[model samples]
Target: MTDLHTHILPFTDDGATDFDDALDMAEMAAENGTEIIAATPHFNIPGIQSRSVSEIKDTFEQMKNKIEKNKIDISFVLGMEIFASPTVGEKLDCGELITLNGTRYPLIEFGFSEKKDFIFSVMDDLISRSYTPILAHPERYDCFISDLQSLYELYQMGVVIQINKGSILGRFGRRVQRTADAILCHRLAAVAASDAHSPITRTPDLSEFVRVLDMNYGDGCSPLLLEENPKRILRNEDVFWESPIPFDYQR
Candidate 1:
């Protein structure tokens, strides 16, 4: 499995505390069947402290070296779960921010209660510039949870709806889990990620994640979400997506 969102790059953000913790997390992910992981730390949130790309990359290299020394059989890629803002485009243009594995597809997130117009605005801005924005954990946001029709519209706009494993399993909350169910039911979510933060809480273990999809959404769904699409993202290839079923909302 290729987990496209994770906070395993230590000392960069609210993820692993140190190199030791990161190694443990990597081992956990590998044992749980995750073969590839993207170290997508949170970046450019309002009023939050941030790290420079060089700093983040230095730590990423350290983690990679440690993984190699320890013989952990997993691959790592550097990225950020960028917070939406007007300056995001400029940052990307100047190389201050990077997409997933340096691909055109950038994994992005927004305020949980942010307005839909703003969500679509940033997404449209990125899309108009020929960048594919992957919305991280849309099920956890009130914007999409309340107006699922708009979520489908995002799908139509060619935005990649990346759902979190926690949301699917109700680890975040009941409301979030319900929203995840709706997204899955309508096939709005094109990709799924661990969004793991540590070895323990919000950990990177994908064992149960594999089981849940196999039991709930069998017949190639598991490989599609956990492997095929993520591999494509890493390779900078066009991802295979399913057409989302529209809601019956009176718009």
Candidate 2:
């Protein structure tokens, strides 16, 4: 399995505190059947400036060397979970931020209570610039959770949806868990990631979620979300997405 979203780079953001912690996260991921992981630290949030692109690359090189030295069998790639901002396109153009694995698909997160119009505007801008924006953990956003129609509209706008495994496992909260299930049942979620922040809490592990998805949604579901789609993102290929069944608010 490939974990598309994770903050395993030490001292980059609110993820691993040090190199040891990052290595531990990688080992845990390898133990849990994850072979590839994208280390996506937070980027461009107000009052929080993560490592620059060059800096992150340097850190990734150091981490890779350590992984090789330690014989940890996990592939690591560089990515950033960019917060939605008006200058996002400019940043991308100027090489201030990076997309997933150097592909056009960028993992984007919006404010928790951002308006639907604002969210759409940002997504539209990114799309207009020929960038595919992957919405990170849409089920956790209040606006989408309250009115799932907004999420469906975003999906229609060419925004790929990624849900957290913890959300599916009800680790975040009950509402997020229900929303994750609803999105999965509706076939709207295109990817599943750990979105893990640390080695202990929110660790990088997808085996349990894979088991649950297979038991409930059939064995095919896990491979599609955990492997095929994420690999597509890494290769900059268009994802094979099913037409989402519109979410029923009455449920």
Candidate 3:
């Protein structure tokens, strides 16, 4: 499996605390069958000092070297979970922010309570700039929960929806799980990731989620969510998913 979103960069953001923690998180991911992980630390978050692009690259490289020394046997991609803002498009255009593995897909997040129209506008701007924005953990957002039709429209507008594993495993509670399930059930999500933050909690373990998906959704869920689609995403290739089933079938 390939985990497209993760915060394993030591001393970066609110993710793994130090070198030891990052190492452990990587091992946990490997043991749980994750073959690839993107080291996406939080960036451009308001009121928080974000690491410079050069520094982010340096830290990512250092972590990779450590993983290689420890022989954990996992691959890494350099990326940033760029927080959504008015200037996000400009920053990305000027190469201040990076995409997953330097591909055209940028992993982006927004305030949970942010207005619906604003989110769409930001996404539209990015798409207009010839970049596809991957909306992170949409199930946890209040605006999306109240307006499923907007999410459908974003999907129609070429936004890639990413659902977090924690939401699927019910770690964020029933409401989040229900919404996550809706995205999955409707075939709206293009990928799933650990969005793992630490080794102790919100760890980068994916096996259990895979089990649940297979048990509940069917055997075919694994290849789509964990393997083929994510792999294609990394390669910047076209992804394949079923046409999302409409919530109201009669509509």
Candidate 4:
């Protein structure tokens, strides 16, 4: 499986602290059947510190070398979990921020709070510049969780929704877990990612979550969420999405 969002890069953001933690994270990822991983560290948050592109690349290379030396069979790709901000367009134009597969698709995130008009405007700005924006873990957004119609509107506005694996399995919290279910039931989420941080507490793993999806939805649903959709993002190809599952708010 290919995991599109992860924090395995060492000494970057709130992920692994050093090389040892990184290797351990890789081992956990490998054990979970992740063949390719995109090392997406947090970038451009208001107070959260992160590594620059050059610095993140260096750390990724170091991890690659270590993996090669240890004979670990996992491929790593470079990406950034960009926080939605006013300067996002400028950053992309100046080549300061990295997009998925160096293409027009960017994985953007917002804090778990109320929504505002500017957030949608930023997404519009990206689309106006011919960039496809994928909202990371949209199920975790406090504002969208209670209002499926708003998320549907965003989907109509050309935003792809990504659900965190932890959220799917209720690892984040009950509220997030409920929203994650709603996303799946409504076919609102187009992709699923590990969003792993470390080896232990926030380790990089996808097996358990995949199992849950398969058990609840069916075998085909797992690949659609975990593999096929993610591959489209990595290749910058247009996504062929499934129809939204009707909202079952009774749950």
| TM per candidate | 0.97, 0.97, 0.97, 0.94
Which lDDT values do the candidates have, in the order given? 0.89, 0.90, 0.90, 0.83
lDDT by residue for model 1 (19-96), tens:
999999999999989999999999999998898889988989988999999999999898999999987877897899
Q: Which pairs, if any, clash in model 3?
A: none
Instruction: Rank the candidate models, highest lDDT first.
Output: 2, 3, 1, 4
Which of 1 and 2 is ahead in lDDT?
Answer: 2
Better of 1 and 4 by lDDT: 1
What is the RMSD, in Å, between candidate 1 and the native fold over all Cα? Answer: 1.2
lDDT of 4 by residue, 1-251 (tens): 88889888877788888898888988888888988888888999987765678887888788889988988888878888999998898799888898986878888999889474766888888888888898899888877777777787788788888888889888889988988887787778788898998888766788888899989877877798788988888888987677775543433
Deviation in Å, model 1, residue 167 alpha carbon: 0.6
The model with the greater TM-score, 1 or 4, is 1
Kindly report which residue stretches of model 4 are placed more than 4 angstroms away from their true locations once superposed. 245-251
Report residue 193 deviation for candidate 1 (angstroms): 0.8
Which regions of candidate 3 deviate over 4 angstroms? 248-251
Can you list the residue pairs that collide in candidate 1?
A: none
Instruction: For model 2, give the 10-residue run with minimal summed lDDT.
Output: 242-251
